[model samples]
Target: MAVSPAPSSGHLPRTSPRSPWDAPPGGAPDPWTPWAGPEALRRQDPELADVLLAELRRQRQDLQLIAAENFTSPAVLAALGSPLANKYAEGYPGARHHGGCEVVDLAERLAVDRATALFGAEHANVQPHSGSSAVLAAYAALLRPGDTVLAMALAQGGHLTHGSPANFSGRWFDFVGYGVDPVTGLIDHDRVRALALAHRPKAIVCGSISYPRHPDYAAFREIADEVDAYLIADAAHPIGLVAGGVAPSPVPYADVVCATTHKVLRGPRGGLVMCPAELAGRMDRAVFPFTQGGAQMHTVAAKAVALGEAATPAFAAYTRQVVANARALAGELSQLGLTVATGGTDTHLITADPAPLGVDGPAARRRCAAAGIVLDVCAVPAPDRPGGCVKGIRLGTAAVTTQGMTEPEMGRIAALLAAALREDAGTRAEVAELTGEFQPYP
Candidate 1:
């Protein structure tokens, strides 16, 4: 590969994105945004620079099917790598414990304002370190250590924080899990109501990691009310869709909504929590003094940038295309003999069993990985029989959609995936050829 140096042009030359496809959300654009890092790092550490270049090549070569990943815009990237990373603001804006918190305070305020407006919530806390951390804060704000919590079963699509024994949620709280209908692959509301009545839990959580449909927020709210339980929505995956108005907003239904800025939101890898005005103090304190310390100011600025971008009509179109692409992939993959969980998806994610193709989930994942079609495997737990489960692969369209691929490309990806699972050695080159036409970063 040949290398060329970026001119030492001042901020005046870097005003706006050259094209709407790579446009920055409106504001004073980042003065230092670059497709790659500044030339200084390449000159200072060529070894580390090689690793970064390799990652760039890999991203451009492989299909990123992981549901939890996306390419942040260069503007967001600039914010994440900004000087705000040097700050140590240990509390909410306007009330930080640190002395020099004035400038970062403005960025945090903007993040909260944009987040609340984007999701139609009364309050927002853009501070928790990750989705799991945000979940922990929601718990700290609303539940006691020994309190009973009713949530989706881990084996049935729930996240680890929904009460996996290996996580803090399970060790500190009593968890009663409600599962989906085995045949339909959808949450059985009757079962959820029954569990709530039987347990009388302090809180009822509504969310999942791999389930392909929206959780019935209204129904969950009703059940929580019947049981006098607080409704906590761990909306880590669908929050971006919510922002784009492609999914139902849980703000009006759930008592606290915990989410990640990174996933479909395409922000920095961090968390945000939103709630009604009454719970604002508890949520803020929970994110700060309770579960975390200083906020990552750089990430906070990046989140603001992403949220602003999400508020645009362009991002809404992007999200719609994401779901469209997911549906196309699901339909084509199922046609190729994989059993798509829930028949298809109402969101950007799809979970499919590859066993009909003569490959289990892990094996299929390896086959795809070898051919550069990266993805993850998940289990669809069956409660009727002891230890009964279905192994499956989980993937999403956010990243590819961000890269501007649509349903036509989705068809090609499906064919390539099926070919890989069938041990076709030519799949790798085909994948590279496809992704090469749709680079992640402009």
Candidate 2:
């Protein structure tokens, strides 16, 4: 393994011109400390400190391509670790069920207001524990149990929570799924329309976890209108892009939109639900005293800080770069003779169905891991098809591109993937050396 010098850390370089894999001071203290534990407790657990330090270093070394992950900013991290974590604000701002929640209520209210401005929604609920939980709350607010719901097919780029048999959406409601066109690998509006007419669902989910193409929310709205269904746009993957005005905003087309604060929003690891003011109270009630108890004030504060950042000009530029980086990565991968799902991506995530490359998702992900390129396997439909064994692999450019990777980096990444897949040990060694060439996340 040839060792190369490290590049500058993305924003604020943590270490000097030294190895990022080095251990942190105080023998690996809890990264989420000063809040999660007492000072005495942290002092008593030095071994646990070592483990966390190693974990952070490991995370820095690997390129996280998983679409669901991101590098939260230190500002947001600081808010999450602040004293707000100790407060137990059990209700909405200015109307809390508990006392001494003035600051905490302010934090939560700020998050709500920021989210509203970011998405231009009539109302925003920044309280759900996560994106899925937000969606669950939306369901509770809009439809009754056993109401028919239409969503995208999981194998064709839908989320498990959308209607997968394993998820709560499926367990509670009658589900009818719509998939993309087989020949074009894109969402088929006509097909979705047909499903809507047949099912007459109470709701239709309009976003996906693995979709590489931009959704036509207007068309989806038409379908929902045809069946009197509420369109819930799960913009978890592209909310940041939409917020930054780089992608289509679902808030206008869908009756409600649910998204995670982290993914593209680059906020705290939480969820947001946006809807008309008429439905806002129902959504809030569904989230609090209905689904969850007290809100996570610290997380809410972090979410507020992140939403503020997203409202800035810099975050828009970052979102734009994320799209550009994804397209570059897809084009470069295609050059490597790898078939990217739908030929490429319209969002941040690229789905590469490696059937033509003579590999399955698990094998390719394993190879990618060995080469220091983190990738994940997606569920592929039709196990009997030539390249169809739930073996699809999905990668995104949000994190690495945010780290400042450009076209040149994409080119290098594609070459590394090709070499790793080919099992060329010598070439693999050369590729491994390149990992150190870039600055690991600080």
Candidate 3:
């Protein structure tokens, strides 16, 4: 895809006038002031409060490109910091193992209901603390110990929970691997089908953390059906796009779907599991007694807030702009002679090897960070010849887009990235200037 030309002045369109706080809650502006308790904490422990405030300042200043990260709304943050964090709800809404559960029950039910509605799933478990836990719970719910499972390979963008040898998912289950075609950098459906038939695995896991294209969930479902394997879609990265109706949902095809609330969903840092009605009981049990003890009610409440925001038309526009910004970034990078994996992005992330610029992934990441552009070192597919680890840097526009950056901003960012790779001294100042204009949480 070609990079869209920016205006002659090199400026992009401004962000939407609609602010998240503009909407009235319950048809009226919230009259209660945002709590000033943080000030009390600042007075009580100046050092710790300074650390928290410093982190917020850092987020406000840096150009965050981390694919796995995003900025949650003030409402979500408020809920996370609420007193519900004091609760110890050890079970589901109606079946808690502790007292004083009435209010927390409402929070969890709201989270579950909103999540189900967002994803069009029959049931949702909002308790898993992170995406890893959600993936583990899904495995526990469907597969017995040592059951054979087929999943995408870690080096090719699959997450650790999918089957990294270091993770419990690999230790507990017999896992076989698949990868994207090296030349195309896309999953080959024929290869997946062949592997499923050959391994005869108990489960097939789809979805990825770094892949920049849309997943073929239906193809995975067809292969799963042919081999009688349960299809698990770990959509931790694209859940917001899926919810916003920009990306195809895995719910209609997969037997189980797992996601984190924080990524593009812009919720608090938490996880969710969704499955068919019949699997709901097992999934709930796996999440509660099997993987976690008590539910994090505060985070659940925050997720409820995010789900509510995601259901709005404004969020849909936000998510679509996220994709547009990603494509612009990828296209601009490629136009500047960088090799963006899969050519360009159809999603919010782009993986580019900086080898052409005479640096490895880690070195490039350090350079970018020094310039105040935050991203991560990632692996690329190496399907043909033997080489050292195929290292690259992964970038995402979710955070920047949330801050209202658009295509011209993407062009500026791409130039900064290039200058960063080249170790140009001026890049840092340029990055700081750009970040100043799109201050997060402002």
Best by lDDT: 1
Question: Could you tell which candidate, 2 or 3, scores higher by lDDT?
Answer: 3
lDDT of 2 by residue, 202-238 (tens): 9999988888888999999998999989999999989
Output candidate 3 Cα RMSD. Answer: 10.5
Worst 10 residues of 1 by lDDT: 28-37
Off by over 4 Å in 3: 1-34, 383-389
Q: Which pairs of residues have clashing backbones in candidate 1?
A: none
Q: CA lDDT, every prediction?
A: 0.89, 0.81, 0.88
Q: TM-score for candidate 1, please give it.
A: 0.92
- Candidate 3's displacement at residue 152, Å, is 0.4
Over 51-144, each residue of candidate 3 has an lDDT whose tens digit, in order, gives 9999998898889999889998889988887768889999988889999898789888888899888888999999999999999999989999
Task: Per model, state how many residue pairs clash.
Answer: 0, 2, 0
- lDDT of each residue in 1-442, candidate 1, tens digit only: 2224446653325556565333355653333544334453564577997898899888999999999999999899888877788899998878989998888998998999999889989999998889999999999999989999999888888899988999999999999998988888889999999999999999999999998898789999999999999999999999999988899999999999999999899999999999999999998888889898999999999999999999999999999999999999999999999889889999999998888899889999999999999999998644454565677799999999999999999999999999999989788999999998899874
Runs off by more than 4 Å, candidate 1: 1-37, 381-386
User: Where does candidate 3 have its weakest 10-residue lDDT segment?
Assistant: 28-37
Per-model TM-score on C-alpha atoms: 0.92, 0.88, 0.91
